[model samples]
Target: MNYEKGAKEILENIGGKENIAGMTHCATRLRFNLRDTSKADTAAIEAVDGVVNVINKAGQYQILIGTNVPKLYNQMENLVGPKEAGSKDSANNSGSSQGIIGTIFSAISSIFAPLLPALAGSGILRGLLLLFVQLGWLSETNGTYQILSAASMTVFYFLPVLLAITSARRFGADMFLSALIGAALLHPDYIALMGDIGNGATTSFLGIPAVLMNYNSTVVPIILSILIFSYLYKWLDRVIPETLKLVVLPLISIAVMVPVTIIVIGPLGVYGGEIIASAVNWLIARSSILAGIVVGGGWSVLVSLGIHWAVNPIMINNIATSGIDYIVPFTFACNFATIGTALGVFFKAQDRDIKNFSMTGIVTIALSAIIEPTVFGLLVKNKKLFLSQIIGGAVGGAYLGLTNVYTNAFVFGSVTTFPAFVGDTSANFINAMIGLLISLIVGAMIAYFVTKKEERLVKN
Candidate 1:
């Protein structure tokens, strides 16, 4: 269906948007926190033209919208206003800690979902630029490189602003004004002041010992700050008179929050980020191969269940903080193995339609790192190929870990973006290529042999 019609149907079926306390979109779902669940029409929502399915979990009414979710979310938001708010506690909160954990992940998914396209595009550009520079056709010190680098890093440098806008929408705050708070966090004056603090300058805000922390490209601090800002803004809106509200609200919120973040939240956010980074690092430290094996082996299971997003924060945080990541090599191996399995499927298929679809899956995996086509089209229909691919993933993961291979940037796992995994030295790239080759050979051979055997048994 058209975006508008789909959006209208969605709104009407979900109690006309008035029942929505807050709304957020993830990679494939539109999550709604409703003031009253009884108002929703679950059956009609399921039958909406663009909807894939309906889910209710983590105290959310989740409508599956596939990749078009962001588009639908925007259309819905334009129809309604900035969405409404619940009380001090959001309606999504649950009593059990496990449910709360799911809620947090749901929020993270929604917050990051809108940002991925921009990030993916920038990452690709950065990868291409890095490739040209490595080939000696471009120079890092050249103006072209400088311009592209700025383009690539813009979202990262002003990440707070993007997070502020998305999180504000999720938490039911004024998105534009919260973005101003984000802008202020990265203001030149504040950045310059942070430089002084880095150089051992002591600073204070209204007699409070200021604990300044760099906010650029960070995740935790910005989200925390926005959460605080949302409540403060909502509370002020209630107390202040409507006539004076616009003039007084933004002024008071900023005046209070900027200092609050700088002196209190920012430092704590740094601590929180460090803890997150450290935990991921610690896992690999215990034993890279064991870690790789566990991640590689279970990665497919996680992806099949849509739980792989749980690992995204750690990998992104590692790249953001340390400029490198060890956790994602397993992803690389898994992608290569899946591609190999798809190639085997292509050769083994007797049906013309199956053969044509398998070829498409092969191309999809080789270029885009998306293997759902292969997984659903071939592997789920053929058990042997799936198991072989998983085994190949484990083998590749262990070998990469043994070689100490690492990726220096955030990249979707695929051969098309191999340059993204290249490090300061060529060795990293060589090792990764080795891992790729081994994964392909092992997985493809197993799939071929197993398929042949199964076909023979069927004939008999």
Candidate 2:
């Protein structure tokens, strides 16, 4: 990908490292908050070999780079510096000016992007373990299976501790204290206490009636707890004297925050998260086909606008709490449909420019399931290709819904992650493969015909 060359071009066009206040990336774009946006040369950036397209949004100069963004971001960071509060233009980098959606996506990316690589590894491992067990190569009860499952599940089961650290960093809270709060939530005695309460036994913390909610594998609760911690940490630092700040603050903060979290913040967050999960499940239940069609067909629009990740925590929650999720199949369809559209365009486009663009996009999507280059670079520029995407996505999505396909884990885009779709039986894996094949085949055919017809009309 010409890592060093691309990094140099980006820095030069975006007004050098000093112009960058801070930077972050989502699934497909490098979002940079620059001290001065007018200084960037958008034309030069678009001309960069590996660059896709650029946009000014979210209080940042966004450069779309598909799935290879992390590598580019690392190279850029080495060239410039780490993106954080310590940067040169940090004073003007706050998101107050970035509307609601921008702020939301920024926060979502900060927390989830850091965790995706780990989550993908664990999900793939879990899926592999299931595949081996189902094939009778290993018994479900085998010590090996138990150990592997523990390793796989621990990422989720103890996710709060992970989120605490990430959330603490995102919210500018104390990472160690946030982790301490997470540990307290998962402590063995605490689980026992929750079990007792579940069995009709009573419990209290500091004479306050404590809620008996399990925080393991949960998302929102720790976020809320850490939010409260951040505020408390700041407040304590202000009021507490210097001599006793370290010793007295940590002791007092834990004592007060832990009980308040268990009694109030944790339950509230749980309920809110549950409501969101329940609502999505309800929509799927109301009409799986309808939900599938919208999510599958229109998800690209969401991705284009960079808001698709708002659903990340929901997907994770559904799998963690419900044992399976229907949402991913729709996402899977969207990804494959994109690849199909790109392939079809590559085959049909007569112009060398369009042909080369589509071919490159196809290879990228095939390997990493990244659609930005194909999308912004080609699909959006070609109406016929996008039409093919809609048709293909709808077909794949409906197939998933009608056949009851689901996944217990989430992997990023790519057909290679198909193993994660294994269900209690082989039917799920089989159904998903067939549906994906049909979606791609149908989309490509449509795109090919559309291009042929357009060419004939032009000739006539």
Candidate 3:
């Protein structure tokens, strides 16, 4: 693919660099906050070579370009220049019109999208380390194991720091100040206070008792704090005299926000995360098979709608709160089901373009666990293939749910990361493998037969 040429065409169709208010990219999509989305031509953009799909959703114009998105994004970024920090784009200014749900979805996607690669890598490492231990190749007490464990766990343990950096970018807060707040929440003294709380040791600020909770690996606290800090910093920037702005702004913002976070936002955010996790847990507990069937069968639909990012927090919170999560475990089935369906297309489809595209999707999905190329490029155009995906995913999901398989770490659902499915019992991992095979074999079989039947009908 001529990324540079394709990038130029994309910019031209998206109303040129001048139309862009903000620009970012995730694993497989370029997200643009356009000053006037109406000025952008979606059809023309999609017609560009290497471009798979163009979606105007969640207040951003997203271009799906598969695993090569980062390379193209670099080209586009070079052309557009660095996106202005805290640009007041329509996406930022028109939150009210987008409604609460859209606003939240956009915020979550923006804040977490960039972090997925790091999270996925660390998760894979965690799984690998566990495999080494289980196979007796690594001893838990060995210094080598300790260092490797730290490498795998560092991102998760200091998640707030990472989240603060990303959240600051999203909310237009000073990254350092936001990160300072996250660090302050995890200060060793504050963590020690968790132990002291039982000994009648309580801390207070301005006569208000501060609730000291472990903010390490928490999702919502830093986000809520940074959101409030953004508003405060903007107001401060407006009021502070131009000469004293540099040091005074950060000083005052940190001083006020950190204490406020400890006193109010931290506890509220913790409670909020708990509530969301509890709701998911309650659903899973009610009827695991039903929950699995819905999530697994409908997972691709959520991704197609671009709202699947919303589930990330719940999965993270489940691990932080319960030491394990079932969400991603079930999605494993969907991932394999997608791979199987794509393979079916490669084998059965008559069109040269569709067959080649399906082969590309299979390799991409198997390695990176990204399904956009498959879901958007193939399944959306073929009802029979999609039905195969739904039936295969549901059957696998039901089995996984019935068996209650879960994982301790958050990993991408892919062939390489299958070790991440290690659960409480040996049988748990076995059951997960069975689910993957069931989804793959069933999806391929159904797709193959259905496409053959379609061919017969065409002949008639």
Candidate 4:
């Protein structure tokens, strides 16, 4: 296919990969963080034979080339080298014009992207534990079950600590100080305090009314706290003498910030999260079916533009407040459609390189649930496959809506949410399972037949 030539040409048309500072792919596009958007020849790139579409969003230039994008991505990566050519620029531009909302989303996505593999691994382990327990292979009281469940639960149960460290690093705050903040939030004392408050007891920290809220399995509070910590840490470093700064700054920051977080920041963050969560819940309750279709069909598009992070807090809040969320279940169905369609391409591809690329993309999508490789590498170019995924996602989404499935966990997509179904015995769980299975089967079947017909036509 002369992938190198194609990649080089594409890069050149977009003013060379050097003009690109950072790049990520989502279901149907190569989202490029460019040095300057004006340098990109969007029209020229779109004129390329396999290119599908072009979009500019969230300060990124996106080139859509359909499902076989991962192959081209690899070739582009090879041409451009491993590290992004312009990360410094990306970091600089990150804090500039996008506003506070943009900065927050960018920070969260960048911080979490590296840790997603571990997160998924832990989720899969948790799902397996549930499966074992459900099948009677392990009892909840058994030591083996206890150990395995701990392996999975530890990550989610102590998630604040993890986020504290990652968010600290992302915002350039003191890691230890951030960890201390998270630890305080998860402390037994704090939990007890929250319980007391819930039971109609008043609590105060140094005469200030203490607002007790559980931070476990929560997302927004920790991130927000760390962002505040970052600015505080920076200020402390500036005022304190350099030699004493290292030792004393962290100590002072922790002492001040931890109390502030507990007594003030955490409560405000939780309250804000509640408001956003309530709005989303109102929307879902009012029109779950429409929400399902819109979220399911367009989530990849949202992710492509980095707008998906806005929904993260809402999903976590739904789990925290309502015990389940419909958006996440539909998200799973959407990813399943992408993976299934990719699997079809892997099986049906005649070109050796294309076949190998599709196979690898299937594995990546399964483990990481990153759909860009599949969307750009295979489906977007293959009209039948693209239609198949859309149809499958819409069908699954409507089914989820009709059944009113709710997911307790936060991971997005089908395979990861499988365990969420185990905790529920209602028709919602069954409907979710059916939605996933139907999306996989229908998307794959349609892709197979369609791809075969297309291949035959090309040969003729």
List the candidates' TM-scores in order. 0.83, 0.89, 0.94, 0.76
Off by over 4 Å in 4: 1-35, 38-56, 61-92, 95-101, 199-201, 317-323, 339-368, 382-387, 412-417, 426-429, 441-460
Which is the winner by lDDT between candidate 3 and candidate 4? 3
* Candidate ranking (lDDT, best to worst): 3, 2, 1, 4
Best by TM-score: 3
Expressed as tens digits, the lDDT of each residue in 233-274 for candidate 4 is 878888999899867997898888887887778778877877
* Tens-digit lDDT track of model 3 for 177-289: 88998999878877787784532346888898876677888899899999888889889989999999988998899899988998889889988988888988999999999
Query: Higher TM-score: candidate 2 or 4?
Result: 2
Per lDDT, the best of the predicted structures is 3
Pairs with steric clashes in candidate 1: none
**RMSDs, each prediction?**
4.7, 3.7, 2.9, 5.7
How many residue pairs clash in all the candidates, one count each?
0, 0, 0, 17
Candidate 4, position 338, lDDT: 76
TM-score of 2: 0.89
Tell me which of candidates 3 and 4 scores higher on TM-score.
3
- Cα displacement (angstroms), candidate 1, residue 346, comes to 2.4
Residue 88 in candidate 1 has what lDDT? 36
